[model samples]
Target: MAGPGGWWGRKSTPAKVETYTRWSFYLIALSEPLVIGVTALGQVEARLALLFMVPVVGHVALALVLVSRALDWTAGRRPQPLGLLGAVGAATAVLAVTSLVLTQHGPDGEGAETVLGAVFGTTVTYGVGMMALAMKERRRVVWLVAGYGVGAGLVASALGVPAVAALSMAAFMTAASGFIAATSCFSVWLLNAVYALDEARETRARLAVAEERLRFGRDLHDVMGRNLAVIALKSELAVQLARRDRPEAVEQMIEVQRIAQESQREVREVVRGYRRADLEAELSGARGVLRAAGIDCEVSGETDGLPAEVQSALGWVVREATTNVLRHGDAKRCTVTVRRPEGRVVLTVRNDGATAPHGSSRAGGTGLAGLRERLSDVGGTLDAGEAGDGEFRLVAEVPLTARPALEVVS
Candidate 1:
């Protein structure tokens, strides 16, 4: 692994990055012998083989440096070019010197042949190894490999050892660069496509959720709207009939009860889809509960300035508070306030709900917990506790969105 201090290094990343890195190393590895080997092949007598060793050494050094860098990249490091090039030069020198000592000298005929083979084989390995380490872009440095291939091909050719075969190898190495570039380009495109597909999937999920909400809203409007209209009409009819004749009015009275009961049921069901209450609905529901419980209800201040999200949230608070008041506090009166002044939307529900019931206190339940979460989701909070002895007040405040209703409607 290359450390942060150095320029060229491998750092851990995706497989595609690694693949390109591997290919780059391959190019470097194959370049060395081809470069020096081909260029020196035409006349390999006297110091010719020694001359051949120069590029081979250069190639080996370059390969070592590149391999180190690729490893560094694999380990999540980026490399510096000058430092990387220096390392490559150093490695080629070592390998070239090693090859010179071991194989550059000719022993007798058989020994000369064995030494040459060893040198050539080692040279090839080092060349390939270096290319494998260099970054994909850096594999351009492996053009030196083509030199080796061409030289070897030419040596085999000039000596009548079959030059075409050697040059063909050169052609193959030369062609690889284009293949490498093409594959890298394709990988980048594939990555982008995957990201785009993920984004599309996410958008569809959001749309599905929204459609489900809209469908529920329609069903709620149908059920509640029709029942409320029928109940209102039947009540009116019962009133008129009561004035005209007692027996006939009594029959209308039964029908009114039936209609009222059905409307209430429908409202509760509609409420399940969304606790969809506006300012008016909450006030009306609160008023009825207070009247039924023989408590006085009072609300103050305009809520028109509040956003629909905030209004809907506060409406839940009002309902839960009112329910607690009647069922637990035995409240005689309750006051609710919704107002915006000084850049804040304020909501308060207060009652003598802090009083214990028959010398016992009641534990809060899901309604209150749910109201807290609801308010929090709208960037508000619920605070319910004793304002003083025998007095309970729940205060909630949220930022006001000026066009609250229109925002919700949209």
Candidate 2:
């Protein structure tokens, strides 16, 4: 039931580029028969026109198949389409020869030469362009185009065309086919670049997550490692003393219990600090991260008098929203604003170039759900959805008066 607009909105940036490139080629292929074949029908006899149209239509169909397979191959979705490329090349040569024969021996009309020349030139140019998509090397594409030009000249000479006319045919084929070939090459390059950029963005987000995890792990180890070592040594000493029936064993055991309790409290503090995000630090971090990722990020906010709980809740919102902007949509600009109004702190993260549909639940994953839970604990609210004009906005509001008591996990 989705309309074209809805369907288009759902596609990612790379997907959209791929669709445009693919359909552009499809239109080019379809235009051949629609334009050139119709012209041929008007110039030639109906029966002869059908004869020429049959092969042209068949070539167009073949070109369509090649376009899909060639694009798929370029995208790494399929193996190189060597067989199809060969078949298309052969078909193009056959069509070119047939058109030349028609020009020389078939019905002589005012438009026959023009129509035949178009047939020959169009078939050769289309074939070379489609074949260019399968080629990864620019040198190979250059050679392919040059070779086709030479082949066109040689074929014309074999059909008794004059030397000058044959050279002219070669030049025309070279220029036309080279244009199409260059277009095909550029399309392939642009598509590949778009995909590479998308991959890099995803990789950067993953690396950011991974680096944070490593930091947290290092913090936990630094807090607990020496304390656990001390506990083990004290327990061993207590065990040895108790075997000798010594009163010092009780003292050592009590010391061991005290150290264990202290270690537990220290671990809890570390975990609490790890979970708590500072609004100022998060805003600074988001600005740097987004800008590093090529997004123009402007952050205007202050957390000077905000309570710790309010800062923590909104800080989490900023982190999650920034990550989504990098990983989900193709955001080019991000604006994060924090303001205190109506006895509440409002934090808004708005970004443009969002590819997600309007009113979608979330962009990437359940990060939004987890964020909502975190905000709810501090009496904060989270709102996120696509705004108009390819923008996404996330807003988190926490009352200044709401300061939920923090509990230390034992």
For model 1 the local lDDT of residue 28 reads 54
For residues 205-294, could you state the per-residue lDDT of candidate 2 as single tens digits? 788779989998998899889989998998999999999999999999999999889988988888878888999999999999899889
The reply for model 2, stretches above 4 Å from the true place, is: 354-365, 405-410
RMSD of 2: 2.2
For candidate 1, give the lDDT of residue 167: 73
Best candidate per TM-score, number? 2
User: Per-residue CA lDDT of candidate 1, range 353-387, in tens?
Assistant: 44532212224456666876677676776676667
Provide the overall lDDT of each model, using Cα atoms, as 2-decimal numbers.
0.58, 0.86
TM-score for each model: 0.31, 0.94
What's the lDDT for residue 29 in model 2? Answer: 88
